[model samples]
Target: RRYEQRIAAAARRAADRWAGYARTGDQIDLGAEMRHFALDTIWRALTGHPLDQATERELDRIATVVAALPQLPDGEQAGAAVAEDLARIDAVAHAAIAAARRHEDGPDGPGVLRVLLDAAELHPEYTERLIRDELVTLLVAGHETTATTLTWLYLLLDREPGARRWALDAGPEGSPERREAVQALVSETLRLYPSAWILPRHALTEDTLAGHRVEAGTDLLVCPYLTHRDPALWPDPERFDPARFGPGGSRPAHLGGYLPFGLGARACLGTQFALRESVAVLELLLPAFTVRFLDRPAGAVYSITVRPDGPTPVVLAAAV
Candidate 1:
């Protein structure tokens, strides 16, 4: 409960930041702002403190490293290519861990880092290096996925303006109907452009999958983007229809047919958190302002995650 409260508070802060920018008529990079919002939310969860601008700037390297991952050579070559960015990320991680060790709590209070630190007292394996690794892992996984998802959602809304109206008209603000409608917007967006579009798995033993034989140690890539768009599973699969997720709307019943966050035990741990934060921000932004994209990306860049290939510059105005 306490953890959830902290997350909500952080999300509110991010939303407030956006609201301020909207009121001032500030031109904003929607994708960058979304990234900031996600990082701020997760940073608070990990450290019991809101993300500082300096730290946020340092962490920007995460995107660069993620973008470069696909093209980089394997093993030592890859590590060498990203060594500078890794150093910057490591410096930030070590500093945060050291600070958490020195201070029992941050401004908001003790956070997940404190919990890990507490465990270190009894578990010799939770070394400082391991703690840093965990912290960085959470930062990378938690922020990038949510940021990309939100960015894609906005881009989708820009293309399909009626979908925004559909959600706002579902019910009054804060109403269940409205929330569900907004969630459907996100769901449909995920259907089209799942952030972690591909899930890689290795077979441990000989097996059969969908009439195909797989040998032990075989590598497999499960692509949700492709599955979500399969016409056999989704009617008019290429269309952007949030109603597919609305009450009584038609959608495939098969679990494998639509998996934006993967499936089964290995599903994304931050699924609920991502949904909550995305919906919370939309609750405030969607009803209050209309975003006009100054320039839209030509296409997507598929790498560690599928993301807009270019900047998402936008201007905002108050909603009538």
Candidate 2:
């Protein structure tokens, strides 16, 4: 219920932004727009303060750094660069924590930071830096995945009328059934264009998958994009059919094949958060505007996560 409320508030803010821009027939950078909404939501729900313009810019910079790291050369060079970015992010996160602790009396809230702060009091050994690191992890991990998913969802929905109609009939936000429909669309979209398409795992013990033998200490790679479209698992997989998830539609028997958030305990903790966020944004935005991707394949660039090579240049016109 708390997550739902946060999503509602974010949706309202996003809607307002869209309204203001729609009046001028301006092109809104949704990447920036989504970041603003998510940052403000995280700030208020977690730290109890509204995000100021300056903080928003900081958040943008953090995202930019995160989105750029994976593009760096592999090896010690990349490690050093990542350390520098993480240090910067850590500094910002600690500052936020310090600011929150000054005013916060005790933790009795839904924000992850609040919960962690309360734990900090009991476990004094858990330094403020550690708590901040965990909080930063949650914030970056949670919002980045959701933002990318929203980017893909809008880009795909804008091109498919039938998909859009189904999304509307199901009503994307504030409605349970509609939420499920939107979830289906999100699931399908992620299957086709997962933010973390490539997953790397180490073998705990010698095992075999699909008749391939692996040594005890071998590294393994699973590509969700390929597995999701495997003809054996998905019939006519290239087609974007949300109905494949419907009650009567055919779905793969293999559970791990469609892992946008990875599999097992190591899977993303904020998977649900990201999904709900995407659905809420879609519900609010779709009713007010017509979204369509620009005529060009926005190639995926794998950084820390998968995102378009550039701004997912799209046009969102006021829906008449």
Candidate 3:
């Protein structure tokens, strides 16, 4: 219910902004636009505020910090990397907690923060600090992965006219058929260019992944990009064919090979959320514009998350 209200509000804001750009015929940054969409949605859904001026600046700064860190370093210094992120998470959570406390009198549960605050009342052990940790995790994971996916999706669709046309032909956001098409597009994009290209795991005990024997404590790096592109599973892997995911195309028997979101209990909690968010934004954008990518020799840069090294420029002409 909260998510729906927040999304509806954000959609209104997006439509207004989109209208302004349409009138001016001005080039808009879709990446930045989607970033704002995610933040605004969170603001409305989680915080009960529609992102005040100060909060917007802080969100932008947070995005920058995450982008700068790339990914947490593994090995001996892993502790330090975690500590750094924890500090950032702490700051964001405290800000949110303080804001929620000021407005605790409201009805409708007062958004996600208030929900946590309320939970703390019932569960005596649920402390404010614990609430902060969870909120920090939710915000970072919710924002970064979805934003990266949306940016990459825009870049890929901008390069492929056929995919863009198919997406545009899919009905509006509320249409079930349209939602399925959007999901296929998102799935195919993740297969080709996953936001978290590499997912790391440790062998709890002696085991084997595929044919490789894993000893206890062995660090296992599962490369989704490599596996998703493997000719054994995906034919003509280089091609941008959303049809590859349609009922007809082949899929690997070992679906585990492609891990955009990790597998088992450790997998991303926001997997469903990210998919929904990406599809929603794509459904909105695809019907409105004829997207064309500006020429650039860009490829993925390995970080904590994979992202385009520079701006993925595109021209969004009106689909008239």
Off by over 4 Å in 1: 73-81
TM-score winner, 1 or 2:
1
Q: How do the residues 96-121 of candidate 1 rate in per-residue lDDT, one tens digit apiece?
A: 88889898467889888888899999
Better of 1 and 3 by lDDT: 1
The TM-score that candidate 3 achieves is: 0.84
lDDT of the candidates, in the order given = 0.89, 0.73, 0.71
Q: Which candidate number maximizes lDDT? A: 1
- Looking at candidate 3, the ten consecutive residues that score lowest on lDDT are 101-110
* Best-performing candidate as measured by TM-score: 1
Error of 1 at 28 (Å): 1.7
The residue-by-residue lDDT of candidate 3 on 54-141, one tens digit each, is 6666566656566656544557666565666556556766877987877753232478778888888899889887888777767777
lDDT of 1 at 104: 49
Clashing pairs in 2: none
The sequence of per-residue lDDT tens digits that candidate 2 reaches over residues 161-181 is 688778668643567777677
**Better structure of 1 and 3 per TM-score:** 1
lDDT of 3: 0.71
